[model samples]
Target: MPATRRSSLAIAAALLAVAANTAPALAASAPAVPNAPMIPSGSAPHLVGPHGEILHSSSSNWSGYATTGAKFTSVSASWVQPTATCDGNDSYSSFWVGLDGDGSDSVEQTGTEVDCSEGSPLYSSWYEMYPAYPVNFNDAVRPGDHFTASVTAGDGGSFTLKLSDTTQGWSHTVKKTLSNAALASAEIIAEAPSDASGPLPLTNFGTVDFTGAKVNDKPLGSFNPDNITMATNGSTLATTSPITDSKDFSVSWKRSS
Candidate 1:
């Protein structure tokens, strides 16, 4: 649909947030089903973050799905962008995660229309999602310190990531898992696009196989698949929304707890 980004630190905060506010007993209760929602019917496919024992997904402001196929004891939504068609009605390739059983719950949850069209930037909007719980992370990272690829999804999909920082800006290593194969190995290559060069392709995370999986799993703006790192200099990291506009969408950086 559009460019969306989530970091390990951000996911950590979400899990920690959930742990801090949730009742111990409730958090411990075993999930009866996989929480991953079905594919959302958007201009394209998109991904939803994972929740404990559940996957979250939604399409527009009306329908949501839970896979119930794969269950986790404790989960934080996370995954790498896929390589597939990334243009009109093709930008979003797939999405997983659940919404409240009641349709239209996301609108109230985030206070914005679930439908997001390109060129439509929402300054600040809230999609109130009824996730099993909020997944927050711990506050342990500092500027300048970093690592490379910390693992996203390992099932059939896996990715290698990297982080870079400088007085000028920051960049995340880019690598991706092939449709049906885990990205055996990937190295981030910095190739910024100039006015002449078209959008730079994300650094190759390595290649495995892709027979039936969608070619472009993620759209261009929805994420920095180009492997461009974020700069924290001068610009305040927009961890929380600070303005009001016409968009409200949230992504989960998943990790199993």
Candidate 2:
């Protein structure tokens, strides 16, 4: 895969500029998904293996998984949305479960975002089929709400993404088709999305815990595992929160870059 365009630092920045023009503004009271691509952007540095599999990432993000040799047909995780600190900057971050795009052209992902704009925080749910942009659902999400997200590959290049807010008793599911999917990696991540300027400043959301993580029906630890932290400009941006078992772990917000 040779660190395809999606993971390239230069290309990610270029795409951000193009996509930013179409990105939507934060909605008031109701969460809306911005038109951000789910690929790695320049602001967050990520390491890739010889074949292009993601090894680790730094800065406003963390990716947790074991390299399953791309055979993963599905991935899932559950987390509680963290309260985010808004400092009047247009900062953003997301917690998602995805397959591919770490080392492949396609990523099928679903998650929730906590974003700060104009001194306030916006909460929303979304699903993305990458290369394409993310689509926001109208589901109401609040800090501390329990959410579960998953994506499964179907026959003939089809995928089904599902999101559930157990705390709020709301759920949404969608099925879509995407050709050229590499299916080369699966990840559970907390990320900073990109905008015209760059990766939008990361929101100062506290620790986000992801539990019941599984790939191909196997627990996260069964594959090997990479614990990631985000760092920028020689400063730590995020750290892996403590976990009692492989099935669950956390990514804590350090300081925004």
Candidate 3:
């Protein structure tokens, strides 16, 4: 499938899910807002290798590494939440690890978010079974907090998503089921959050470093994942560094939108 269409479908599914769960009065009072759902922006072509592996790709909303061409049962990563620099314009960003949503519709993911709201940085954490609205965690998230997250698919479509903040001493584990999940991809990414309209402006997160990234109990680099850069309208918004030691990399922000 074309990259643009794949991304659009993901966002559309999330919107439908949100609409279904909203009450008429609430829906009328305010539009449903997504909590840092991943929405690839722009229409960059995916460069495929001779072995059907994605070599490199670009997205308007995502930057980092994603491994495809396999059924991913587990994915995990750790990072320190990057601080966001706020300005007059509102912007949003997230750091996450997940399975699927690269070549298929469903994504089982959990992560933290830093958003510029009214010129101030707001930090939060959440998990989402894509096509379903994200559920926010009430625990506080702060810049520089060390966070570890993982997602595992179990028998009969059961799935477990976990996120923890070592700095704050809080953790959450959620169990959900998605019988038709494709489990097609695994990713460790930094992203610009989206809403029904489209991707929101990316927050100026400076940089976030991810370590111990693994998929299926092996280092993420073992699969030679695609190196993804975030861009829009020919402008580079964020860049991903080469993975070091098969498990470490960083995504640096260059622009807000």
| Total colliding residue pairs, candidate 3 | 0
Model 3 CA deviation exceeding 4 Å by range: 1-44
| Error in Å for residue 22 of model 2 | 20
lDDT of 2 by residue, 122-162 (tens): 77788888657677786567888999999999889999999
lDDT by residue for model 1 over 61-103, one digit each (tens)?
1121122222211111222222221122201111122112222
TM-score of each: 0.18, 0.79, 0.85
Q: What TM-score, to 2 decimals, does candidate 2 have? A: 0.79
Q: Which one wins on lDDT? A: 3
Task: Single out the weakest 10-residue window by summed lDDT for candidate 1.
Answer: 107-116
Those runs of model 2 whose alpha carbons end farther than 4 Å from true positions after fitting are: 1-63, 66-68
**Per-candidate alpha-carbon RMSD to the true structure:** 19.7, 6.5, 6.6
Cα lDDT over the full model 3? 0.79
Q: Rank the candidates by TM-score, best first.
A: 3, 2, 1
Superposing every Cα of model 3 onto the true structure, what RMSD results? Answer: 6.6
Candidate 2 Cα RMSD after full superposition onto the native fold (Å): 6.5
lDDT of 2: 0.69
